[model samples]
Target: MQFREIIRQALYSLGANRLRSALTVMGVAVGVFSIIGVMTALEAVNKSVETGLTSLGANTFQIQKYPATVFGSGHRRNQYINRQDITYPQALVFRKTMEGKASTIGFMLSSQANQAKYADRTTNPDVVLTGGDENFSASNGYPIEKGRNLTTNDIRYATNAAVIGSELAATLFTQGENPLNHSIRVGGEVYRVSGIFAKKGAAFGQSQDNFLLIPITRYLNHVKESGSINITVEASSRKTYSRTLDHAVGSMRITRGLTIREPNDFEIRTNESLIDSFRDIERAISTGAFIISFMALLTAGVGIMNIMLVSVTERTKEIGIRKSIGAPQNSILRQFLLEALILSLAGGLIGAAAGTATGNLVALQFNLPPIFPLLWITISMAVCSAIGIGFGLFPAWKAANLNPVEALKGK
Candidate 1:
């Protein structure tokens, strides 16, 4: 049969059952919409998360008590006792042991949205308060822009000195008069601004430049309840990362008193490990999306089959009349198959458009760049069309094979 005849038959059949065809098309559209929308949103957020994880320099690794990504709260607290602190002493041991292999820097951050006062000047509470020991600058890439980095002497004597990030400096001090000698009150104690940090821009939607770095010793004294004292280890190079990590873990396991067979209680986090965690989350989301979308598609496929069967039944006498007039069996089958394809393709286009819009809308709200899952959209539409053909086959074939006599008798 010619292409024009096939199309004519498709349009006539679909238009003849206008409301039913629309409802069936809506079902397919919903399926594609669910999966495509989710994929786009996730791609945008995943990009943001990856940028955030690698915000710290590539060579850096951190040792702490908890995993980098904490899911649904209170579970960690309830399941484990002895919420150990990676003590200052333990970190010192790690530093001494790692020696030439990796550069170890000890830090402990205590963040509070506390008021900052400088005479009549009041700063916002959202400012980050980071506390680092002597090696903070080298290991974490926080180079000093003005005054010297914190020294062992500073931590030893619990010095009342602080370093401001570039953004925080701008907010507090005016006209580039140097914030180095100025004093700011934090938690009711006056701390002299000893240095200013160069701007590092935003990391994972949070401003990295909006922070203050003070001696870790002073932080421990002031914010007595800081959870885990983190030890950051910068591996010698990317090539040596695995060995460096293994060496750190082995040494830490020995120092922290874990037996050969025992698993270490502490967690070592790196950008790659953080990515693995995100992968787990992404997998879960993808699985849920597949299940939901598949159910919708399955319903649509059943609806297509039902509609195809009804079309075959209603056109019984037409099939008999066509067969008597020498219409080939393959042509009859082609007509039904083409009709189903047109329905699926129509729904797929509308669904792809809707999904893209919804996904981009969500990304915009989260301050993330919009994403188009073009590959997924293409594959999904193709799959929907394939489903229509596959499911409509039996009914189409049955209609093609119907006995002309019985069909003409209106059975």
Candidate 2:
């Protein structure tokens, strides 16, 4: 038979058993959906993370008590815990030491889940309260949109001054009402607004402009007294970044009183390092999704083989009649294989469409651009086609090899 005729016959056969064909197709769709959906969402999140990491100023790196991300056993957690806190005093000494060596140096301490209140208008308790100095804005890439940033005087005297984010400004002060010089209560302590930061939008589905910044001294005095301080430094130029990082490390070590024999007791986090950490996480998740998808596809392939075998058994007499009529064995084999391929391809198309749509929802949530993940979709369809051919081969072979007289005798 011609290839087109075989395809036409396969379609007719599948339509004859519509319910079974649909169930088999659904099995294949489920398998494809799992991998495609997971990969699509991960792609969107990866893009968002890359964009967010750029919020760090150019040629800037941060020194902190812990790594950007910690993922390990209890022993690893305790290792970070046992290290001494990067104290406020240490941060000050480090800043003084690196004063002329770097272009900008800033330190901050933060507490989360705090609310800000202003005359019957109050924000949700998800605001981040931070203690930072004048250089904080420059190092952290937050340009002051209105008024002025905190000054040396604010930090020196531990004054009740605050730099509010755009989101907080919108929530507390109505249109035509200025936020500067207004007294707002943050975590129960009143602070006069010193500046308003430009809108930075959201990252990872969380608003970046929902926090409030105060002077580091005021933060140390009013907020938690014992937390670690995070120090940020900007190299004067890209050419000097490496030397500056080396200098900063040496200076931080000297400030922390670490002997040359001991390993430095703090973490240095650069944008590259943060991106590398996220890449590690992304790789792990992708591997897991691939494994799951592999197993699911393997099971679906087995189901295809079983259903094709049953189909051959039910058509034994028809096969015998065709063989008696001098039909070629290749025609029978091709027809059965085409049926399986059609089912697999149909399911794959449905799954890819559904998965892409579902995954783009995550992009919307993170305010990121939509992702097509064409590579994954192509691989999925290819795998589905392979499954159809590999699993249908044996059944198709059995139907083509049947003895005409025995098949006619209902054997």
Q: Tell me model 1's lDDT, rounded to 2 decimals.
A: 0.82
Q: RMSD of each candidate?
A: 3.9, 1.8
* Candidate 2 lDDT over residue span 105-214, tens digit each: 98888889998999999889999999899899999889999999999999899999899999999999999999999999987799999899999988777888999999
Lowest lDDT sum, 10 consecutive residues, model 2, at 49-58
Identify the runs in model 2 with alpha carbons over 4 angstroms from their true place.
1-5
lDDT of 2: 0.91
Give candidate 1 regions above 4 Å deviation.
16-18, 70-81, 112-126, 143-153, 166-194, 201-205, 239-243, 259-262, 315-332, 357-368, 401-410
How good is model 1 by TM-score? 0.80
TM-score, one value per model = 0.80, 0.95
Residue 8 miss distance in model 2 (angstroms): 4.2
lDDT of each: 0.82, 0.91
- Determine which window of 10 residues in candidate 1 has minimal summed lDDT: 75-84
Model 2 quality (TM-score): 0.95
